[model samples]
Target: MASKYPRRQFLGQLAALGAAVTTVPQYARAMESTLFAPAGEKSFVPVMITPFTSDLKIDYKGLSALTDLYLASGAKGLFANCLSSEMYYLSDEERLELVKHVVKHVNHKVSVVATGSFGNNLTAQAEFAKKMHQTGVDGVILITSHFASREESDDVMMTNIDKFLALTEGIPLGTYECPSPYKRILTPATFKHLIDSKRFIYHKDTTLDQAKIKVKLDLCRGTGLQFYDAHAPNGVFSLQNGAKGLSCIAGNLYPEIFSWLCENVNNPARSADVSWIQEEITRLDDVIGNGYSLNARYVLNKRGLNLQVVNRASKSPLTAEQIKISDDVYKTVLQWHERLGIKV
Candidate 1:
């Protein structure tokens, strides 16, 4: 028999995983009063969707148009060529061109980063990262080392990271626990090594386990490494627990909601307000996504940007079932947005 709590996993209630309580951190409140407060707004960096023409080539103009929409819609940061962008299907040249284009188009309007590393060849990967850094992005993030076997020793993973880091020269680095080919949730020891490097500056923790997330957030504090929990359900709870910001796929559709959470994380008075917003976010995700990329395209279409959801690596154009969900969820989110008085 299936579990009754369909939404529990999505909402971060995975108590079986030994997750601890996620609460507001006093350190975050105190940081605001200090001079060395982390620069940049606590913002959501949407893993942006890639637009495709009828023939599947990059829609350069369409991409620029999307940038305008994101900037206007309250996105303070943009993540490019991530799994959300179908990085697996894109060629190296295409990824570089896409990043360069986004950097120029965004033009310092917000922080920009991309998943620059792809395969196991650390030399080429580092070269690509170096090039991406020159494109004016704030950082280059490596997808977690999924190439290694599950039985692969921690030392091998650490050595791979060290090799990759040595080659990335002047680029600021971050890691995304992207469960793509597979997910390798970083051990606390690996996270500590990153903090000690003084070079790895951001982490998109994907474990979604509240206890471990708290541990990661605590480790990141004052070390200048920003920990952004990638799982949406934990977003609000994690924010209150000293997470520096949020980076999630859901931001592609609902940046305004995430941006609001980041800004108001410290206000205990908004507890009721934030809880409702977060619930809406997760509930909408439950209905609107099998994976966010295609769903995002449909919503963008519903919002009036037309593009084919033509993806070679996965489902494209969405299923009939998904489109039905899209219609219902779209209407619901609009109503919720109005009720919440949200602008985007």
Candidate 2:
């Protein structure tokens, strides 16, 4: 025989279950909080730097001109000292000088973000973040540790964030999560801890797994993390999955394509017109041998940017046949762009 329960007890149990179920949306909202635009805020679309060589050195003049093009093209922001810019190859002084150049050229027309990912030195990275803040740049983009073990990588990330937040006090920071076997993926719990701290203002979700990406979104909900999709090939799908914008290498060679996608993402009538554009961009990635960073540089060269396609200064170099393949792919993409009336 079951014991009799009062109506109040039944109601209390119902309320608890309802609260648990209702928390899902609340959690999602919390995770997504950081990504929201401020009141009356306009959308921002960021373009990456395409490091070009002039006389076998970094081309400051060409860099300035390219930045001016993006500004004139109505880009909302620019990122300096990134993989596209070959930041890893640059010395500390070169990186600082490049940031100064980027800020000077943009001339406050748009936000300028600089990469601050130094290898395995939280103190150095934090100090760099502080300097970038002092330089009056808008933000800093940081990568987690360079450890091969996941546990070690996680420890480095947690420690780095603590130090970075303490050092960079008032400035916004964007963390780039590009998963490699050497680095740890920021788990949902760790992401929540960071987001809840209210120190990190943006995140670039470059992890390839759709499920993991969703988890990122859910974990960061309500934390005011402006999430950007770094995987250029899936920009549209990423936007659909709650990413506020994109920060990508493909944006270097094909700003118009990304510009169109961002503009038409919310407009149903215009979406089909741009879906083809997205598809073409994705196809271009495949044609150039996907996942090779040099592909973007090659595409830019083919577009007559006069940028060198050399990635020798990078962490790795592409083979001669790889370069030929990249160039051939860019030509094909250009022909497709012409056919589609997409002006480069």
Candidate 3:
């Protein structure tokens, strides 16, 4: 069945096939510029920020110090104004200020990913995304519209995403899939379509469903989009499944611990070490994470991080009983921290 063609021409055809195999979409090329280092280059472990102060103002000094601490602790990057960062309670100006400060503090030690989600307003969120890119940040994390059951909400989210991509030019983008706070879920098909659009280069999977996580991982394969587990309590298993990295609020308090767990998770010889850390972290989560309440913050403060225990002034303060319970939990975590050789 071999046809008589010149050997040189046949070789050229094979080369062309190789090039075609490697080619990526133009938009994806642009997105990849800021996405995690080209796939297989290096995996990144990012810490989500939790900015708070007693006066309800953005803690500029504390934020700067924390940013420095995380980078020094071997974190690969920072995600500002995310769920852990309490983005909902912040004003537009305060959000921008936090992004700017984190950018300045990080000073290129690691990439900065800023959250651009706001209440169902695509235009405004796009504007913020554009500004974030202009400030030299690497990426924006967009949350789908909250609590909207309408088909129109999906349309709005898609349109807004398109607008944001167009406006940011070459900035990378990430999507945060947090089902608890947002009533609507982005189905597997819809998620694949978005990734196919080449606008987003990452997905922060906060949904704890193993089945859904597998779907996202399958759909994102070969697209060069990175997936991270925001559900830290389940992160070890998530990484084993397919997550490229970990991004969690727990990283705010135990940056080095999370960083070590991530590095060890990838090395077969270190599985035992990672298992020990994961077990301790899971125990802490059992006591503090159930309510998503004050216990986590109090534990952070007790360890000398000075994070405000209150969620947000705009939201109701933690009840007295909740505060007392949180304090008890904080003491217990501190004891464990010392036992584990984690610095307070």
Candidate 4:
């Protein structure tokens, strides 16, 4: 007899292993050796922010501290060199170095995946992905916009992805519907095509539509692919519907809360708590993204992460109104910790 909870069972085996990261090629010994919570057991994977010094340089010290903070807050994996990290502002060399630094600092405690597709063409993107893979990340994520422009059709995007796969054969890859350039959400048919390819092991979904999310999750039923929804409002819905975990910008603010939500979203005993957190998550979603990673950095600093509010992506500093809003949200976050007995 088969289990009624098909998705759970499909992911359960890897969850039992506790730290099974992405299923990469045998040659990727670094990733293979790293530990990550499988899709069955939900985990938080933060779209990590880049910490900069007063001089606008990549602050390695702050970066290390930020890395430690995420792990301490229960992040099971790290999505470095991403939009949250201001990847577009960083040079190619900076991107690779940033990812390499994160991989070295993580020391295989958990898997790390970074954006590698920054080139203008499929071949350049493939070459960059290969180099990023060499940096010991478990997976290299390709930005969807980098494949095809907004003017292009899904078929054009698919063909380019196929070419990319061929060019960077044998490497573990993932896809990010990055909001930059443009957000090219994959249709169900296109999603099935990627699933059929079996080359992608992760997807950071920005589709934000619950119905679409459900369809995508259905496609991931028994595949090695794990879908991570980036929308904060869909936290409970996505988790309950079979998403592996979250990869939202909100995690950059309260990773512990996100991690807590993931661990308990499916707990029958905590169903009410789950619902309440979902409400809170939905309510604060806009406020959190107002000033974005900068607002997040401010909150993190108040929480004792000691990060400077410096940012290259959103060069403008937070407005007084934004700061006031973030401060209010920060107070609410503390209240949540106290109310739910989550660690401060």
Assess each prediction's global lDDT (C-alpha) against the native.
0.71, 0.61, 0.63, 0.83
Query: In lDDT terms, how accurate is model 1?
Result: 0.71
Q: What TM-score would each prediction reach against the true structure?
A: 0.85, 0.76, 0.76, 0.90
Clashing pairs in 4: 19-36
Q: Please give, for residues 85-170, the per-residue lDDT of candidate 3 as tens digits.
A: 66665676777777888777767766677766553344655666767665656667776543233456566666666766666655
Which TM-score value belongs to model 1? 0.85
Q: Model 4: per-residue lDDT, tens digit, 239-288?
A: 99988899999898888899999899988998998899899999999878
What is the full ranking by lDDT, best candidate first?
A: 4, 1, 3, 2
Q: Model 2, stretches more than 4 Å misplaced?
A: 1-47, 50-55, 146-156, 179-181, 289-298, 301-304, 311-344
Q: Tell me the TM-score of model 3.
A: 0.76
Q: lDDT for model 2, please.
A: 0.61
Cα error, candidate 4, residue 271 (Å): 0.7
Error of 4 at 31 (Å): 12
lDDT of 3: 0.63
Model 3: CA > 4 A from native: 1-50, 119-121, 146-160, 163-169, 179-181, 290-297, 306-344
Evaluated with TM-score, which candidate comes out highest? 4
Across 1-344, the per-residue lDDT of candidate 1 in tens digits comes to 11111100001111343257664322232223221123645767778778888788888888998888877767677888787777777777788888889988876666687887765467767777777776766667877754255689778878877888776654567788887766889888988987887767668888978998888888888775777777889988788888777878777666667777887767687778788888888776666557457777777777777767665456446778877877777787687678667876
Q: For model 2, how does the per-residue alpha-carbon lDDT over 1-344 read when each residue is reduced to its tens digit?
A: 11011000000111234544643322233333323233223233554554656334667877776787676544666767765665655666777887888887766666677776564355666776667655556657766433123556566667657766776665566676644323346788778877877656667766767788888877765456777777777677777767777776666656665665776677787667668777777776655444355666666656656665554344555677777777676666666557546665
